[model samples]
Target: MDRGGLVVELGPGAGGTTRAILDALPPDGRLLSIELNPHLHRLVEAIPDRRLIAHRGSACELPAVLAAHGFAAADAVVSGIPFSTMPRAVGARTAAAIAECLAADGRFVAYQASARVAELCSPHLGTPRVDTELLNFPPMRVFRWERTGG
Candidate 1:
């Protein structure tokens, strides 16, 4: 895949996936990571990467935050948020926000504990394709969504 567009990451707990994206993207590509936890933000920030910018905020504010950064859209939005831990209302709102931030052809990739796929999909803004990954701790399912229509 081309690595020339902006990438937004939601709920990157400690920058593990963030590191992977940074390594994959070109120098001209930009990565904006939103982390809700202050402690996690500090840990993510310690990693030296001019391409990575960690925002201390919630995923629900993704669209506005990306706009404030002069980005109207992103090529992809990857998430590692703990959807199972969120209340239904918040989860629904966050899901909406995620859909809003993506460009028409943009992709949203999220990783959730295996047991939470049904719960997570219940509030998703668009249809998602889920793939289970038993290699992860506690095992996980990767959900991918692509906005339909341009």
Candidate 2:
């Protein structure tokens, strides 16, 4: 993570990943956490971090969300959304928005129980490098993609 980078975290859920991101982020860095559930958004908002902006909204609104915060692009975008469970059209739009809003060479990392995210995002962001965590019950796949070319 860059010293003053901008990061967007989707589906922060209980905020476990949000806390980890804050711990690693430099004090000057900014974190935008977008969670669809109102209840989960409140939980993330309760995390007392000035650098954290907890937004309650859909990931499909990512570009607007960034603009609303005066962020032109993000250094990284990390997502925990259940892509496999979302409608294909919505997932495709969300993936495209993420690719469009990332800074050149920015990275996108998503942890999921299925490969559906890869199918939706690969066209816009290119192929991802996948890693599996066996420690997690039922296991989880981590898909990472880096922006390249134009």
Candidate 3:
């Protein structure tokens, strides 16, 4: 995979996707990851990648967090957050943050087990494009959202 621009990953639990992102990024590309869980943060930190910076923080604070790291906007925001398990308020805040941090053309990709894309993101995201990934455990779906000047 060819790394294109600045990439921000939210809730990269266990670093599975973080490793993949590191491999996909170009030498000069940047990868900023936010993990709310302390254990998950430590796990991802173990991966050796100069381009990867793992932050033990909440996704709801993404804009400030990314800006503090010198990132004005991200080209892509990937999330493995457990949206289905989170309360509506928590998920709404996270979705709002993700939308805020993304560039106009940036893609927000979220991995989920259920097909409740609209229900989980409609409060923050405009309209999402859903794609199913049967290969994932429990047959998950990937929701890709683009910011529409909200």
Residue 123 error, candidate 1, Å: 7.0
lDDT-sorted candidate list, best first: 2, 3, 1
Off by over 4 Å in 3: 1-4, 147-150
The best candidate in terms of TM-score:
2
TM-score for each prediction? 0.89, 0.97, 0.89
Candidate 2 C-alpha error for residue 113, in Å: 0.6
Tens digits of per-residue lDDT, candidate 2, 1-150, equal 867989999999999999999999998999999999999999999999999999999999999999998999999999999999999899999999998899997999999999999999999888899999999998999999987644
Answer with 2 or 3, whichever has the higher lDDT.
2
In model 2, which runs have C-alpha deviations exceeding 4 angstroms? 148-150
Structure candidate 3, residue pairs in collision: none
The 0-to-1 C-alpha lDDT of every candidate, in the order given, reads 0.81, 0.94, 0.82
Please report, as a residue range, the 10-residue window in candidate 2 with the lowest summed lDDT.
Answer: 141-150
RMSD of each: 2.0, 1.2, 2.4
Residue 27 in candidate 2, Cα distance off native in Å = 1.2
- For candidate 2, the per-residue lDDT at 107 reads 91
Candidate 1 lands at a TM-score of 0.89
